[model samples]
Target: MLNTALFMQQIREHPIVATISIAAGTILASEVIWKAVKFFHSQLSGKRPLRVHEVLSFNELGDICAAQHLRKSMPGSPELTKSPEPIVLQCRNMYCSLRNVGKIVEQIDRAVYSLDVAIYTFSSLILADAFKRALQRGVSVRIISDREMVFSSGSQINVLACLGVPVRMPITSKMMHNKYCVIDGVERVEEIRRLKQRKWIRPYCSVVVSGSVNWTRQGFGGNWENCILSEDKELARMFQADFTRMWKAFEKSENNLKQE
Candidate 1:
């Protein structure tokens, strides 16, 4: 036994679902009618309708066009107008490889203008190659690596510097343990401080990738780690400022090691 009344009530309550269902039904009915018309025409004309499968009925075509126009003309949701929140990504040892984060590397490679990287340990040659490609494409890449890890067995910071990327290391007894990167921060216009600021003004827009994951093979595969990708302009501006400050502070600590 089916509860027909209950189902009808539920459909009425969900207007969006009801609308979608109606649209789908209409399209299905229109398609059936179109096929029938084509079949009838073929019988009368004593020939097959040329490209019959490719042709859309006038009503169906008009509906599709109207829907597209509506989609284009509609205003974006308020949430969409703001910068997106951070998205979390987790990886575990002996499980799925965070190497899929290579997508993030690809993004950094395609950076139009600038890249700011701050990592405590960096040994991944895959990322090193991406940085080199970015440099070749005229993208300015600045790297901040831990002073100690730069001399580690597998550190590739020196190799990156040899490829014309600027590399900086903080001169501190305490490790600069941050692992993050900022991509393509485009500066915005200066704000007028005199007026009562009603609207939010982003001084720069950027993409920030940060978290526990270090740029190492073990970090991406053997070790448990988490990372996030954020497109918030305000957040990116802060990261850019922090990286700039550290880069300036480590003025004399630039890695000048020869590429091996």
Candidate 2:
């Protein structure tokens, strides 16, 4: 009886502590209830979705986290790696990943002969400067960006065009949304300087970098983004073909406008 009375007295004296304890208890209870509801809802819906514990599955839109649940699971298949060889992956906003913008600049700075870039939007001066340096180094740099977004504040589209870098933009009500770059013609090597140092090492292949990441301040630092760099000739060729088609389409449109 005395201990009970003492406990009541303490609770009364420390109202804040009692309130905090009550709040914590309420939160815990709510969490349990929420989980129970989710379980019941899933059962009723008769939908079995893959959880996080399962292997990763990425959609076409670059969103990897879907139907995620907390559980301990093994990693995915070995073939799901970036590529069999000469492929690298750069990710941001999860785990330990490289800075997207820095990696992009590095990719450009290390270019030996050509750079084919097709993006939805671009407004980063750092990447612009890298393009300028590449141009100075006799590297062929071509850019394809969204026509609507090229006039936005801080856009480097005009700057590159003025500097004699071939810039292309499509005219359309829909967006030409693609984020990818093809470096050189065949293999994608992250360490181009080291490759060049070896006299026997030739630019055998091109690198294809494609992902949800965009070359912008918000895309790199503020938002969750991801990029994959691969040295597969087939993938590089696919992207390069698309870029060529888009470039030619825009060029044809410009010529039609001039004729009119």
Candidate 3:
């Protein structure tokens, strides 16, 4: 190893080299000190930087958890994973649903290409107006409703049919209790699976799902229900596939009935 004094002597012999050497030494010392201090601080200070694990409104966490559960026990196609964080926000309360509907309508209004809705009931006047506006904007709107319970959705369906919204009745002897709405042609799909059909009124105590939401006016003022809204594209894509399958199947059944 070169002696420090000898090294200094050699640098001094070349003043330009001396200056560069000193500057480099100073920068090196600063970096070493900075790193040392950082290490010491990390060891001494209990204040570690806030680690961002994931952001999940209670509803979003529910989506992530539900996806994981479905990935485990359910006999469905596996979902794509783009992010571990699968949620953005949760809309709760009777007013929350109403409040959220406005946002949903806003999103629907901005829809450019296509709008598709598969609803158990489609009687919300506010939602119907949004659909009409979308239709006016030249959006291709295709709605599939339960053939059995068109009572609640009767007015909305007639309005849509009058307004030229293509509505199809899913051919099923069972009630189409699945309230799944896909805007922009299933850009996002929410899977609402039945947990239990409860007798007592409970705000989503029985069933849960990851989706846009059910159209039931049950929230803070009404009964209770729970569902998660996800912006996760990967998960939505999978559900969209399922929707396409069911849509085609129902359409075929309807077509066969027509032929009969």
lDDT of each: 0.65, 0.65, 0.52
Total clashing pairs in model 3 = 9
Q: Candidate 2 has which clashing residue pairs, if any?
A: 186-205, 186-206, 187-205, 187-206
Candidate 1, pairs of clashing residues: none
Pick by lDDT: 2 or 3, better one: 2
Candidate 3 lDDT, 161-240, residue by residue in tens: 66666566766577766665554433321221122343442111011123334454442114444444443444445656
User: Could you give the candidate ranking by lDDT, starting with the highest?
Assistant: 1, 2, 3
Between candidates 2 and 3, the TM-score winner: 2
lDDT of 2: 0.65
Cα error, candidate 3, residue 106 (Å): 2.1
* Candidates sorted on TM-score, descending: 1, 2, 3
Q: Candidate 3: what lDDT?
A: 0.52
Q: Write the per-residue lDDT of candidate 2 for residues 164-203, one digit (tens) a residue.
A: 7777777778887898888885422333435567545444
Candidate 2 deviant stretches above 4 angstroms: 1-98, 186-205, 253-260
Candidate RMSDs in order: 23.8, 23.3, 18.1
Residue ranges of candidate 3 with Cα displaced over 4 Å: 1-97, 153-155, 185-213, 216-221, 252-260
